[model samples]
Target chain A: MTEASDTLVEEVQARFDDLTILEYEFDNVEIELARKANALNAPLYKRRAEVIAKIPHFWALVFGRAPPEVETYIQPSDEKAFALYLDTFEVIHFEIDDPKGSPRSFSLKFGFKENEYFKDKVLEKKFWFRKTSDWEGLVSEPVKIHWKKGQDMTFGLTDAAYALAQAKKRLPPGNTDKSKERALPEYKALADKIEESEESSASFFALFGFVSSWRYVSAEESGKIRQTEAENLAKVKRGELVEEPDSDEDNENDEDDDHDYQETEVFPGGDEVAILIAEDMWPSAIKYYKRNHDDDDSDDDDMDDVSVNDRANENDDDSDEELDIRALVNKGRKEPTSNSPPMPPPARKKQRKA
Target chain B: MTEASDTLVEEVQARFDDLTILEYEFDNVEIELARKANALNAPLYKRRAEVIAKIPHFWALVFGRAPPEVETYIQPSDEKAFALYLDTFEVIHFEIDDPKGSPRSFSLKFGFKENEYFKDKVLEKKFWFRKTSDWEGLVSEPVKIHWKKGQDMTFGLTDAAYALAQAKKRLPPGNTDKSKERALPEYKALADKIEESEESSASFFALFGFVSSWRYVSAEESGKIRQTEAENLAKVKRGELVEEPDSDEDNENDEDDDHDYQETEVFPGGDEVAILIAEDMWPSAIKYYKRNHDDDDSDDDDMDDVSVNDRANENDDDSDEELDIRALVNKGRKEPTSNSPPMPPPARKKQRKA
Candidate 1:
């Protein structure tokens, strides 16, 4: 073995003697730990119970077999139940709410057998808590689930589940109806009015072209940069969309007017072309422009254009971050019909859907 | 107290009994006990030891002082310690590959202390494992971590640290070809198509418009309809595009003009006006279209024309779904150099800056 391998083995031998994975006496202890730590701003996300309590129809997936532990609060008759069982485990980890005074989060995750005939079926439960729990309830509702044998969905949910648990346990209000409405543009427009708007940078054109993809630029996605036209310009001036454009169109042929993202017979007017061109290459185009477009100090251009857009997205994620079960327990759902968009970071979850 | 109160009290009293949690023994056996009854297919996850190895920083955040556990890999002298710490957590939680046969996920989640000293600290660690470990190596690299709390960063890695204890991980292949250029539009001429092409279900246009908050509609958006546009007639004559117009514009518009969404704003010039307008009312608009417009027959023709735009950016809360770990891990980085657009349901994460 190489020297590194030898050293690694030695280190491994040493650690085996020192480290031990601690399991809490009960999942509730994790909640207690989180409450103590979150007062100082710690990360405490432990799935208090292994599953989501409300899954309208869990047994249907498994056909006639429902795991034993899956008690019927309301089991649909068509679905199958393997058995009734309440297997429990101690959760030791916690998600930090603040991150400062809190130590580290550790919780116990346990699985309850839900159905055997459906194969190795069980209701998975994770117990998580955070410092925010001190003010309200301690543990989050059980997030119950059913998955195929060897097809656990936790990979997508583990971090996301806890992130949300902790955030909900920690952060305050941000997502609102007004905010949701402006999330797309009004509240998020990068707010960079180029003062010299005289000569646009190559990046500006690049970004504009990129956004065109969303608009549907079909003719030349490969290598051609279609030239912008006059009628399209007037429409743009009037705030009308034209067509989706390709980036590689040669500028030399601008006067020839035959070459444009919408130049072909596809569109009847210039407005439709711009829309296609605009949406396709935006994010990258925006990045490039933000990197190079600020030469002539524009109006209120202090904030990076990309940053503004990013901030909006980040703020949106924040809602994902603050979905604390502690808070949920403290406050009853106000608007039953409307659900808040989760502010994530704290809310990033492992989803099987993706 | 009422019976409900008595039950609550009994539950609380039982909880106070300090029952052991996860490690609860069944017949004095150390192995996990099967709940009293039944079975169904449900998976469980456990974090690899290596993930726990780098959590010193997480511990530090809660305690206001990192545990000796973290010191070996991240020293006070290393400014990258915080970054490294978060990176470790992010890497382990979000990137661990989903191998075939191993579907459940394991991640460590912990609790925070409720004090001021360790503000923003990490209290506990929850280890989550996913079902895809079998496929990790095919898509991603093995994580390299310094195991010994006292190990020197400048020194080489130890074998123990690189053991199979590491979770196999994968990076979603978001095709990125930087050398490729964006397509720019022939902005000026795209306007004509706005006036001539087909139009979509008015509701789709309205919803898209509302969501994007397109204060006003431009002809470009209005240029094409799902059915047929006059320009397509010309295109068919020229054999430019494949499908011919289903019917002439005047003929189709005769019966469908009423299909415009309730919220669209016609552009100044009749030339270009946006038609697909589903926004804040997306769910409703689609529902309405599905039930009223199509019912069964006419729906097929207009379905393609419904332009439902993702007007509002959905920030994933990591709500156990639609997660992007790379973004979550490198959240501290000013910007992550990612190339793919965020996906629906679960998001594709931003990549490391090369």
Candidate 2:
């Protein structure tokens, strides 16, 4: 309505008219997660409402991001089980717990689907933005918000939340204890999925799953450390990980060497002594037991490595969003080089065995 | 025919016509345990090749059964799984180290259908039988087999022995493993109608899929145990578990009147630790926890007085089968009635989490 503002808007639109908005990072993850938490709660009784509330918060701690809004939820009307719609989101937002909080962050997670899962999954997007920075101006720009429909199987506080929500929707909410009678497959499937993801990665974050305290190593440092490993393995073959340096009588040059079977100061933090491991472990000893026995052998080492990396990513994502069941199943699948087992999405979240 | 031969025929039928067939033993339970021994080889491959060999002998160890005339086995194949049927045959003519070699075994196994599943399953039969002392007579009986048309969800196995004479015209001999793999499910469905009779009592034997090493309470013990429980609960509430005996000094009844919680054990097998136990832990807890949550004056009872006998028969019929997928979402499912969590069947036999 103001002449000055209209004039400014016209100028900006004219300049960026040719710019195409292909991707958008919406702080929708929170909304989406809450939506699912709400959906699963539909079948639960009011007294069991705590189950629904506890689920997402617990997952937000584990998964890294809370995306996927429920498209639909099918509950059996019992305390046993039901189904959920799962759509892993691209944009992730973490509430900035600072004094000047008026809507905080929106960060685009950069990772691509291998094939046609999305048109430009791997193509980078400028995700990070602060709501305070001309946030209204950015909204005017054409942007693409990622959306899809899918299904998942999960359990826990979410299951309780889900049951409670349903119960509240149908009846009235007070104190619900129906959570104790939580469904079977949902709870079990959730446990199974978490373990599977970790099985693939064994990241310090994944380790935090069973043991509260955990250790973490930076992703980049992990790679550098491994490069040193190959060097050490070669040297050991030639008699070298430990060598007598010219500087001393001791087997020196140790300071120049990197750590082996590396450890991290940070891990899935639960106050336990759990250690964050590298992604490479998936293709190695953790899954090596099966590959060594397999009649098939090839040069595609990348496939095995995904199992490890995915696990860590899963944990990292937990700190940012809700868990993704399909992605979790994909973590434990046999290396794709060997016909990867059935679409892992059928599996729940991956976790370590207790 | 000589007159003397007529007398001999009578003797032969008396000895061979009737057979003492032993199926399963109710006294013992067979829990299929997954072995985590990396040094050992999985028999899955060998069993796959011998399409008509005997079922694996592991069932005997699982059920703690004496080796009968036959055994049951489970084998996963290249594309599917096959539950094998085998016989403990006695071949009298064979000899090895000694002149009296206990008739060696000669097993025969075959595949059949279990459901409407097609590509979801594959079928083949393998046997592992012991040699017999009455081989000539056993060979005299011919097996008659048939596969009713239309319905494609069942099958059976019968041998040319035990006086089933002149029945070999129904089916053809088995072929190679590859052929069986190709024919499976389809042929299995075709053969679904081959059972001789459906006996209701025998269904229980079939319902609990055979695995090796489970320990179930003996039927006699199970019944008595349930009955004892019913009486105990009633007595507990009345505070009348002990009765006053006449002609006794005041000191005489004190020891016996304290409580029966310290007396005989009630669990399936925790005889040495005769601790007090509720008839069922979970349900009882649910009832008690909910009811007494408001009552603060009930008792200042010790935790030791809390019972651990809850999980006993809650899942007696179900084998307490919990689905274990590869996730960490909801791993530790507590068994309320019992102190210990319910143990799930192994995920993968050789790679079980210990």
Candidate 3:
């Protein structure tokens, strides 16, 4: 490989490796799909296989083993673009052809559109990349990529970048350390507590499935959103901010309003993430009920003070920052907290997330 | 208690016992919820408790033993109605008032509406009853007793009756059979097959969950529906029935049209059933995919002949009647069989049953 090609390969490999970590968290779903392939719809398995094939180092990154013999080649098309081939199948085309003068602007053409599984589903497949220092102000952000002509199909690459950075942060701090070891001490402690509790291992697995399935935001972003909301709630309880007028009446006007706020566009393999969550998250979901029940028992006067302090404490705990399993497991109880802002009613109508 | 009240209690107990059997089929879900109660939403548990409480022999039937010390009193409100009091709380009011003059006509008023958990949610709480000869031509159908003004919310009594009848059919037959034994040899054989197969016990539990959660129709009705569809498909293959013009173009006009065919209303405790299915069914679902795959391998010419013979043999096997778990597990491979009818695409959307 040439010098430029080597650099490109390294960058792609790094990103692919990070995604593999996320994929590991969702291994239960993969196993389930593989086992149940015969019982499930044929088209579903086809779709899943197609997505897995798109990522580089698929087996090594996902299964933590050497991949089968698969040849890959990088051919430079022009000064602004290059094509990436996997086993004679062109997977992606990277292009820096920008009409507007922007900093390090580039676009990725996901070239597997010709694959039978995706041919009819995807019209145009491309993702745009732009640099931004927003993740802890330490890493660059990639813009949401738009694909499919006349469609609002986009996925947050910024979220993916943030997720990867967060995963790296979990490793023990060290320069020039490329060990596969992840999962901090705090995470281990949390898992231990879950195991020690009356909850089954299914709950723990379910929580992992839920985390891996978050598509609109990265695990880091989801955690940040929860933390921010909790902090805001604490502030409101402390009389630092006034509460907005309730929107319950407006929400009642639209029975299907619960779906209105969901991200319309999804990333590749997003549907699979949702399927995993649905299949695995039920046992852990019981935590929300328990928290709500506990909240219901405490006197309203003292409960508010306790909740506010709890929220504040959570914000300060950096070790348990990203994708706080405890918080995610308990977040559903927010509806019952006396001082917490009223959330919209739970969706009465069943919604099937694809 | 008077003789009439004794008879009423016996009747209620019989039906309640049948329901408890159905509940036992979904025991995995109950245990999961109970274990993870501290992690789940409080309202969910409250709702579950309420449903269980609605049945007269809830404690005795579920625990398979005597219940806790609780007072219950029956008082006739009039010749046509009676009130049932449990621990100074009116739980149900049985009324033999039917303006339509239906045979064996009665209504049950679930009197716990005033409880805080149910106050805002249940606008009307009543169930109607009518005589029916459907279950071996021998039972009565329950109707939805319309109590609330401007509301006609009701559930199918026939479906419930059919479900009870089907459960009875699964039990070994003998005169004066009062042994607590359920599950005929065929059921045991199926369960043994599942246990011996590559699938986990969870998958077996999940199949039960799926069967129990089906709304709009009873287990018997669901079986009948599938059988009818299969027969229709067979006729279509035989060129006895004309095919409808392909509606692929119409379906393309609306991508979100899939949900239009789903049943809008769900049975009570439907959500719990769905949770069970997601948590447990993955391993067994593989059988369907495997069957479909095998079917794909066979040539189209003799495949039809093989399928017809398979279907004919299946019809002859009386022991495999009812919801054959093996057939349900292996149904996905229907494509290769010429006599097998085509099914709609699998539901890709994750629908929360409740």
Candidate 4:
């Protein structure tokens, strides 16, 4: 190694420190921008919720036309459930104004009518902005879904995961090692169940039971960790402490990977799925709903432009279009001509004949 | 298709319109945030420029340690030129305050000492925020390089591209059709040159002569296009105009592809490269410079922990580390012990012997 001039090294370090400070300022500006945007969006979102309430199956149609990122996770059974019972949907930036919390923390609330699928009137999943030893982002716990009888859309996967999580919670403090926890009957049952099922067959309802691939930390724990990190950073800045190197931590991470049940097996890319739903699908609900109308107009225009006049040709075109989820959901579903559909589980006429 | 309830459709459209308005507000918030961040960053950047100037070969070392996204574009000769002649670097968000302009518009300004490479003291390449029929982004013209005889790093490629661009500029307004333009002598010469050369071996200096793959529009033209679009949108909102269908536009794009000299043939992903440099590299220069030092300390620590002691073993380790750009740049090169190196092109002792 070459000998670096002491003063030159200090100069470079000083510049690096200044750049770090500038980054801190930029982060503050982003947080401020989020707070301001949220204030302006609140009233408009409230108005939208009221307007969308009067339109029957509005959310259903929106989900039908959802972007592939979200649609890829929805099973055939999930679509049926959505068409039958899904109602008002909302996303709340719950920590936008909390000084100690991040704007990234948000809640996806889904209101549903009394359906045979689940007992909860409102299934709300919250993603808390979290930072751990080597990872940082939004993390969530499995939301319990009370399914009636044999009506579990996710088959028995969600049920098993939820039961295992409960059993783990009951373990005594300081005795919750990974091997010990896995030995529990509930954990063994869930593991065996997961081993037997094909991940591709899992329903979108499995998302309700999705937890982080890494260790799940509560919001309170995340906040405390952040505070401790801040303190440690300040100490280093003041030259009162030296940062510890995690040279052997890689081995521990590898061990964790060996036994960990990655959330992807059940709900592939669950974090990204939840994020897309909250950030895009929820905010642009109306856009997706209106997109179906545009698609229908374009399809008809293409057929006419191509001079498809035969009845048999038209029937073939209809069959091809039926493969699109939007077509299946809106096939013969009549818009509410008189009063809106009842708040309770009104029998939704099956629109998909195919 | 089933008949859509008129009032219900109207209700959905109205909500969509409201959401669009909210999006407009959100866009305004983002612009305001940029303005504020720029105001804060301006002074810090100025301080950085001054501090970096005092450290000789500062930008050179930083470029040597550039992230892979930037490093992949830089040829071996580019590194030699940077080590010998590149002095200071600055990125300017030139359109941050322009009412009709976008903050995305930025300039990559390189300050170079008098060298055998090019005549320019300051090579300023500006990317104007532009919009065309099917694209919106920062677009730039081929910046002419006044290169010394027999010293053209891009091997006459930049010369050919610059000549063709200049010739195209002189074409009559309506006669600038692509097919006819491609038949021009300068264009034919450039086409032949590109056909013969391996893009992988092209010098990074070609970035100076890069143009957008899409039709390049000046900021003035972009502002006019935006104004017209806004007016058309207003008319549509007021029920005074019907939006035209763009069913044939796709076919026109295919036609454009036939004769267009896609910039990727010269510089693959030039747009993304410029964006990442301006947005990531420029703002985080100090971080990259310091990262090399951290890498060195870690490497040494690993050697000690693994009990590497033999002198021949140490020699082998040094040979393996030679491939690292940081090692090549810093190898046995004594830091400025007395005065910083001169501003002009000083003879930098060649550090890469491998």
Per-candidate TM vs. native?
A: 0.14, 0.16, 0.21, 0.72
Q: Write the per-residue lDDT of candidate 1 for residues B188-280, one digit (tens) a residue.
A: 122222232224211111111111111111122222431232343334334343242233322232233233221222122111111111111
Index of the highest-TM-score prediction: 4
lDDT of 3 by residue, A53-148 (tens): 432222211211111211111111110111111111111212222222211211211233232111232222222222111111111222222323
- Taking chain B only, the TM-score of every model is 0.16, 0.16, 0.17, 0.79
Relative to the true structure, candidate 1 reaches a TM of: 0.14
lDDT (Cα, tens digit) per residue for candidate 3, span B205-244: 1111122212122224323433443454455334343232
Over A76-168, each residue of candidate 4 has an lDDT whose tens digit, in order, gives: 778877876888888988888887889988888889999877898999888887764335666776778889988888778887877877887
Q: How accurate is candidate 1 locally (lDDT)?
A: 0.24
**Which of candidates 3 and 4 is the stronger one according to lDDT?**
4
Rank candidates, lDDT, best first: 4, 3, 1, 2
lDDT of 4 by residue, B1-354 (tens): 234433443444444444444444555665776787687667767877876776667788788777788898778788878876889898888989888888888888999999888998988888887774335666777788899998998888888888887888788863435776777898888778877776447787888777775555555556655775566446535644224335363224324544555632355466778888887888777666645434543434343222111122333343333345443444345662333321111101111111
Model 1, span A198-242: residue lDDT tens = 133211111111111112211222112212333433443454433
Which stretches of model 1 miss by more than 4 angstroms? A1-136, A139-354, B1-154, B160-336, B340-354
